[model samples]
Target: MTDTRVAVIGGGVIGLSIAYHLAEAGVETTLLERGALGSGASRATADVVRSYFAGNPVSSALAVRSLEAYRAFPVRPGTDLPLRQVGYLVLFSAPEQVAAFEADLPAQRRAGVDVRLIGVEEARERNPLLGDLPLLAAAWSPQAYVSDTAAIVTAYAEAARRSGATLLTGRPVSRIDSAAGRVFTEDGGELTAEAVICAAGAWSPALVRGAGVDLPMTAPIEQELLVTDPLPPGTPEIPCTLHAASGLLSRTRGDRLLVGMGYPGPDREAWRREVAERFAETYPGLAELDLHPAVTGLRDASPDRRAFIGHLPGPPAFLYATGFSGHGLCNAPAAGELVRDLYLDQDPGIDMTAFAVGRQRTG
Candidate 1:
């Protein structure tokens, strides 16, 4: 039995971030990935970095703290992550949503999000490209920003390696015998560690089951993304804009425009087509532009659509950090800090009771 202090399963952003934190804290850590790091939903993410959640205090608070951690990373100034502090503009296409947006503003302000509810004329002035679309109202938060998730994950992996964490790739964990303190790999290798963390994203439920725990999680309704060919020169750099009417969000990424839409079920291919069709309808400006092929990937989801984090119920040494739904990209840094605290028995800085794995479920 190869004795390691901690074993982290899954090499997505959440796992890599936690591994980096553990190694930085002087823990002996080994990260096992079924595939290359950042190859899963982490890379497929739309990179929406915002804290303007409605009616979810835990999520809003997490986003607030996580945004701070994200801004503290050296990757912002010197690395390729290109963390840009472009604000988010949530537009309401329907008149009824105006009140909903207004109702959400006070809570957003309470969470310390720099959000302001503005009139339709002000919203159009903010984005001239929005053009004659009859928007009733909008909310703008200057604190919101987007990051290069691929670069962020790479930074975590490199930082973890530098801090002495061993990263193993191409090794799918087949069986997790937590009672024996050993995880068996498909290639017949066994990893023995004092503690094990499951960060397997959409595949987390199966991994937990292998270890004799039934987690209340499911394969997420896959999200779809489309990238447009670079916009014509002189087009305004659009802040991340969300159309509440259709659940479509669009942002500027270098020269190309990145657009995303939420899907309803497990059919990834169907969702991609739906998003592409909706994108054209929602933004008539993009009606002529040829939308690049759609790409679909799974986001680990919980029944309540919040993350499932904290120690697992069956084993004291096993932990869970999965089910970020589709917001893992923005929450990665905060997750790292939380996991580090959990492993070290330190106070988690933020109250994460709502994200606990054993929380009472109504549905």
Candidate 2:
């Protein structure tokens, strides 16, 4: 398929994965990044990998595919992923939360999530910092995992390189001539490709708009993690805890305990105060642990948290693979496979109609 060259805009995880998959599929692929690869939201991820969607079964299924891909990646030919199968627990703080969680249970089970609701005592037994915090219930995902996102990106990039893909960093695309299947950079460098995939993360709107399509999205400065120094001897590593109602989540990163929420910097005082109060009530020792911000960046939010994963309608034929919100890193592999399938005009195995760029949003 000499005529099927693909130029993937954005060398972040999604773009890189798409390039890797495309090149591996024997399509000539080139990936462009303004800076270093995986230096964007890919690395900014909270890194907790799980498949338990709140209500979206399709999204949950994609997540399950992605997590399975990561789990099996190391054994695959040219990859080394530093993945840790630490469990993930979503706690119910109130009765309403329990009800809300129950609504999600059916979808979660449908997505093949190995989970169950446990009592507060079981939660505390698993997490030492969990004092008698009056948690009503908790959903345990025993197969959930975490990883160094950069490492995974590196593995994808390495695999793509091995597959004969060209990776160009410090080269940003300025325009795309969708009609001519061409990509242009600020330096006036141009490359013609059969397919152009927009995976620019937060910077995608402008690029997609320039390509004669408007992909409605938001790039919010998300405070994803509030890390602390190494935990003391008493405080041991615990599963990733997401207090869904409060939006406060915690997991161990090496020796540090990471507390995270979506609060902005202007509300740092309020955020820390609330997190501290919650820690005091639940996790005792980490209550006073000073938070150190790490890998916080803009989250590419969409109408729903789910990603848009289909081809943008065009004579130029562009593929939209951005808008994953906070799930970009974990689902990169599945997204890559989908991009490849779409490019080759093959069935994606998963139903992608829900991810289609709607008629109202597509200009």
Candidate 3:
């Protein structure tokens, strides 16, 4: 069996970030990916980066930190990532939805986020493509942006390799002998380390279960559709906007608009048609836009909708850094730092109890 200081499973944005941080800190790290690097959720993401969580302070703080890292990509990863500051707009139709955001507005402001609760008129001004809907209020975060996720992942991988981290692709981890700090790959390869990190994205639940840890995680298939923008050229482009009541997510990509909605059940066709209908209703002005078939991918989420970023209960050597739900790309940089600090027994400088494994879920 090969030996290393730490063995990180998965090669998505989160895994790559973890490996980069650990290696940069002078640790001997090895990363294993079942497919090519960024072949999973990282590649399938919507690529919108925003730091607006209605109620969760922990997630917002992590996102702010990660945004800083993204802003400093040239210095941190030594590669320039394509980022467009298109901003994020969340339209709320219900009073309850507006109240929830108003309650958390203070915390977000204290975190140095320039988020504002604006009236529907201002919201429509920010996104001219907004239709005449019953928008009670909107949360506008001007610092939010759209990023090139694949480029970011590649930059992290390059930085990690430069820092002496070994990344092994096509190595599907079969099981983790966590008690012994050993990882068994499906291709009959074994690697022993002082610690094993499970950052396997949607596959994290099963991987940790094999180590006898029942991680509370769910893998839900989220879908996104690409549609042509039939609006006039003089019309303003739309930011990443979400209809809070309907769970509809829409953002612009050059001349096209990418739209999707988070569905609770397993019916793919039903979800697709529902999202299409919602899109048509929401953007009545874009009636002529051609709606393409949705591209579906799995996202892992916890019961509390927060990521578990600390070590396992019984086996301290086995750590988890998964379940970012739909926010992995936006929160990956801080996640890498948190995992690195946890492995090195250093303070991550934030209240991590909210992200602790087996924490009681209230939200």
Query: Which stretch of 10 consecutive residues in model 2 shows the poorest summed lDDT?
Result: 354-363
Q: TM-scores, in order shown?
A: 0.90, 0.92, 0.94
The residue-by-residue lDDT of candidate 1 on 75-104, one tens digit each, is: 532244566777888888786777776776
For candidate 2, report its TM-score.
0.92
Judge candidate 2 at residue 35 and give its lDDT: 83
Q: Residues 1-363, candidate 3, lDDT per residue (tens digit)?
A: 448988999999999999999999999999999999998777667788878776876788888999999999998878988888998899999999988898888888876677888999999988887778888989998878888888988899999999999999999998888887888999899999888999998888888876677777765555445555455676677888989888888888766787777753667667767777788778888866767753556577887778988775344387889888777898999999999998888999987888877687543
Kindly list the per-residue Cα lDDT of model 2 for residues 240-314, writing each as its tens digit.
888776777888887888777666657777877777676566676566676766766666877777787778544
Off by over 4 Å in 2: 1-4, 265-274, 313-315, 359-363
lDDT of each: 0.78, 0.78, 0.83
lDDT winner, 1 or 3: 3
- Stronger candidate by TM-score (1 vs 2): 2
Candidates 2 and 3: which is better by lDDT?
3
Model 1 accuracy (lDDT, Cα): 0.78
Please say which candidate is ahead in TM-score: 2 or 3: 3
